[model samples]
Target chain A: MRNLPSSEAGAGPETVDATRRTLLQTGLFGSLLLGAAGATATLSGCTGRTEATAAGYKFLRDADLPFLRALLPGVLGSLLPAAGMERDRLLDDLLHRIDLSGYRLGLPSQKALAQLFDLLNMRLTRRLMAGIGPWEESTPAQVQAFLERWRGSSFAVLNTGYRALIKLVAGSFYGTPAGWAAANYPGPPPGPYQVFNS
Target chain B: MAIDDIYTKGIADGWKVVDASTLKQDQTYEADVAIIGSGAGGGTAAEILSAAGLKVLILEEGPLQTAANFKDMNDARAYGELYQEGAGRATSDGAVAILQGRSVGGTTTVNWTSSFRTPPQTLQYWADTFALKGGGEADMAPWFAQMEERLGISPWAVPPNANNDALKRGADKLGWAAHVIPRNVRGCWNLGYCGLGCPTNAKQSMLVTTIPSALKNGAQLVHHVSVRKLQFSGGKVSGLSAEALGPDGVKRSGVNITVKARHYVLAGGAINNPALLLRSNAPDPHQRIGKRTCIHPVNLSLAMMPEKVEGYYGAPQSVYSDEYQWKHGATGPAGYKIEVAPMQPLLGSVIFGRYGEELKTGMAQLPNMQSMLALLRDGFDEQSPGGSVEIDDSGAPVLHYDFSDYMWDGFRRAYLSMAELQFAAGAKQVMPLHLDSRPYESWEQTRTAIGGLQYRKQRVPVFTAHLMGGCAMGEDEKLTVVDSDARFRHADNLSIIDGSIFPTSIGANPQLSIYGFACKNATKLAGVLKA
Candidate 1:
């Protein structure tokens, strides 16, 4: 159990790598929301994969991948496992679980989430809805900055999107068993924990 | 050793448990009373109606979850199997998260078992304003006592958990009126695993009590069946259509079947009941089908304590303070009840409201965290006329609830009250559950931070477990879907015997309220049929 208060600056801080350097590049140049100018032009930068994988998870369109791949390490930067195939597996499971929940909120919410997914998944729409993207080209701090902008925005729509997206990402990440160490939540009850894990 | 599931024994002993997901062909069934949901209200009603020698059939939209399927308390499994929309159901814009259950026992299987009776003021208001003749505090006392006895409900005998102790200490220091919350459990192990469905069969949820009794008395329960519409003939509900779901419980696999009964009970809680009525195009001459739906929208104040709270252990909840509930009066500023939510990881993580290192830091303090949730009472005044439930283009329910300024004023006051209470309790830092607010190390800092925080729907965190009122029971056909007798005013033989029938929010946790209401109404229904 951790004894210190949050004023103690950091907990489980990590050093960034070269692959992460690829993430810190793009900025919407202080534009929190892309104005009418974004809507007028046809976006051509939606150049990510947009299909289902062989794993056969129900949701997560191909265009959705780059956005999530960019967002997770930022939203769950320190809590998520280090950058590798193991981390990739963890992210995969997180997205899959969130997708299952999407199926449960019925068709309307499913559509709304899918629309949000579509908007964020595409480079042009991501840039338009939120001012910075091609998220792979931005650092975790920049991504965090964009999220905080949405969280502190005067616009209700931006706040709503920020809340929806982060909750899905953060919830799915922290809820999983692999993410338990950071939260210090001893896994399940003792009896059930031993039964399931041991 | 794997626990020998109670359902296995019941099934072996010839309980009429039908897995609708495995149904092969279209089959019509007949019963004296057909209940649409199988949660707290429906389960209670089923036992009573069946015991009264009325043939009963229950259709549950969610799968039948038992000890066999509890899945080692994994939230992922529980939500998928036992919750509405996989525990992902939210309002239209997704501002408020709702946590209603969807399994055979409905929310009773998943609720934190704090049982509270309908407050005297609320019952009196119903009687005075809503044409409820015999539903005043005095008139309904016997029914309340009966359900309380039946459910083994009593004030928790054990000490409050550390998380709850903080609330008690704060209330005591401030000389506020706090009380031990009564719970519906027998031989409880004091485990905080109630939301995942009780593993030890100690919690007397309808899943363990009434549903089993109903089944024993020849009631047939079909799980994974979706009841679509109530078909009417001769001004009464004659039949209803249902589709059997597939293995996944979402896709329709079996042929459609119609159920006919002398009486039809709609116990699909608030959202689904209103959605069903709207879809069937039921006559709402006054257009009050889904208006005035109330949710006890809750806000949390997370207090990082100096000692280890480990809120995830012990009883989920056992203490509460109603000091502010009626301080401003029922009709004055919206009153709120103070309580704590168990910091189970999934729900706790989302409630923390941060990302990256910030969340990581907060997560590390989980053992030392004590949080208080102020369930801001809605629907008493015009300021909180309450949210409405409307259907989407696809006939699925879309709840539209926007927090008004009056409600925000109550929330602001609630944040201040909770922060003061937390500071008074011990050495700690407190933070309102807002995206913008940081952990304030002192009472003065908390007060200042709460004052400046933006009070908007998406900006602040909000949640509700107590979903109440939609097909409100009233005498005036223009104002309510059902009358005080719980019978649909426009349609004979149709009765809403659940939380939806509440004319207003029942000022406390609603399980006991629903249980008592069902007992009274179903008993009356039984008497009417016998006559």
Candidate 2:
């Protein structure tokens, strides 16, 4: 763990490129992929290729789905439906919402998010950073542990990644009426105003 | 009873409203004055200039969403359609979330309707520090009153909902200076969905009032056109090149547009106005265009009230306290105003920032959640130099704001105050919106914990809905981008009539400040153009 104020020390002194490079070199990606000193080659290969998923998502490459799915139950907890078809449907809907939101982000933010996802999706980084091999085989406890690890990580990048994931999941889920209903919200109050759309 | 979507009637009555997204070929507009951005500033300017018998063109980047689109009162839909970046805008490093509006009416269409004049202390600070003139309390009172009367601005008469009432109750108990917030509305339904577009068309936003009036007075409005850059020569704006955005309002269509005007008004607000200037390579001999951008950086505290606060109903903000606002003066360490936020599920969950079972459990108490936010008044002290607006590789505006230790100290103090107030208002437990914070049952416990907590950026989530001060106005060209008359210092015939003209952060909600300044500056510009 490192020690420095995040806003001043972290935001300054390091460019986005520098941060990504440093994150890859010293951390989880380092031990996994860079043992052969192939970091630069691997890093260049990671960009621009996964901009879209084969499933026709504008963002959210196919590899990101399993990781997000594994984290959903832990992120939503009791909010997620019991392990059944209903839960699967809700998860799919939430992923769709998350995908739409991600696609709508500005170019810089989308670029940053893509890099974060790249780090998480790669086999080497996933094993080291998440402490798991494949998200499909990851248990809820493993997901929770990974989340806690990142949330408590000294690196601001990991914390930011954690925040982005949690916010996307929570905000997208809670934005729905079903989420509101489950949360005991009575929904928006009725008003006298109505609109007749032409 | 159905509320008439005014755009339909206005268009039927011969208003020249164009959806640029529908344009197939290149277009050119010739106007006496062209306003880029149709929010509080642009909308206000359009009405005044159009009324003065000048041909005015208003270009909006977002779609022309009306009451018809807002009737659903859905947060997700509203954020997607009406807000900037689908309400996903943040500081460059993702440390602070920015809630800015992008639609035709701009933020005024989606704001919580708290109309506050620029606080006297803030005005004095601007004058004393930035050498700003013609913007003192006395000089601005008439303009403020005129805009107030024009927009039906008055103290909200409705009873405070439980969420706002908690702040009032707490302030009253603590002997703090709290008051009912003024709102620019007519026959408001108190629906608490003002953050969505107002379905009742009663909020007196630019869409409902000034833009429609401008249209009535023969002004033309084109929506979904993004201004690319101003073509400038010899310290004067020549024309602007723009491209029509698609219906999704993200990608560009092939249809290009050019606007030629005798005068150009930049009212794109804070980060945007500065970014446009920077992108256009507008003359910046002093390099002051994008400097000093301030967002009233916000930190919030959540309280689980004993009573059902049900923050998602009634008027979103009807009460506020200014006890700490000017206590230490403007240039001191940082001071903040305390207000409450409506704890709708999505926003609440985002703020709470807990996960797993804790998230579900906390969310289940939605009806009882009362959120208090402190607008940490930045950009006054040397330490609080505020952010700068920089355009990314794609020419999109990105704000780089740093959280100084000075501001973090203010945040720590504000958290303590909010927790104390929540406890005074009989909250069961209060949690400062920090990743390390948990629910504290007592004010003393919260004070101790918050004091000891590490005040880091990612650890404590900060947010800003109020974007202010990028192209600041002052007498010194060395220090400011615009003059007191809102005229660009470097570019002749280019005026900025928006929140971007403030030399520092207004220690209050900035809608009224923008309205009053736009009214004053646009009137002067109209007079000059008429002559």
Total backbone clashes of candidate 1, pairs 3 or more residues apart or in separate chains: 9
> First chain of model 2: TM-score?
0.72
Name model 2 segments beyond 4 Å from true.
A1-51, A191-198
What do the candidate models score in CA lDDT, each in turn?
0.80, 0.84
Candidate DockQ scores, in order: 0.26, 0.33
**Candidate 1 lDDT, A1-198, residue by residue in tens:** 111111001111211111111112211111232232234223453222333332454555555666777788778877877879988889889878876666566654554565556556555666666678587798888788888888887877677778787778877876788767777888777876555334
- Tens-digit lDDT track of model 1 for B196-221: 88877788998899999999999999
Pick by DockQ: which candidate is best? Answer: 2
Q: What lDDT is reached at residue B29 by model 1?
A: 90
Cα distance off (Å), candidate 1, residue A193: 5.2
Candidate 2, residue B380: Cα displacement in angstroms equals 0.8
Q: What is the C-alpha lDDT profile of model 2 across B1-531, one tens digit per residue?
A: 456889998899999999999999999999999999999999999999999999999999889998888887888898877888788888877889889999989999999999999988898998998898899999999999999999999999999999999999888898988999999999987888999899888899999999999999999999999888998898799999988888888767778899999999998889789888888999988888889989998999989998899999989999999889888888787999999998778888888888998888888998999999999999999999989998764566778889888999999999988998999999999999887888999988998999899888788899999999889898988999888899987778899999999888898999999999999999999999999
TM-score of each prediction? 0.92, 0.94
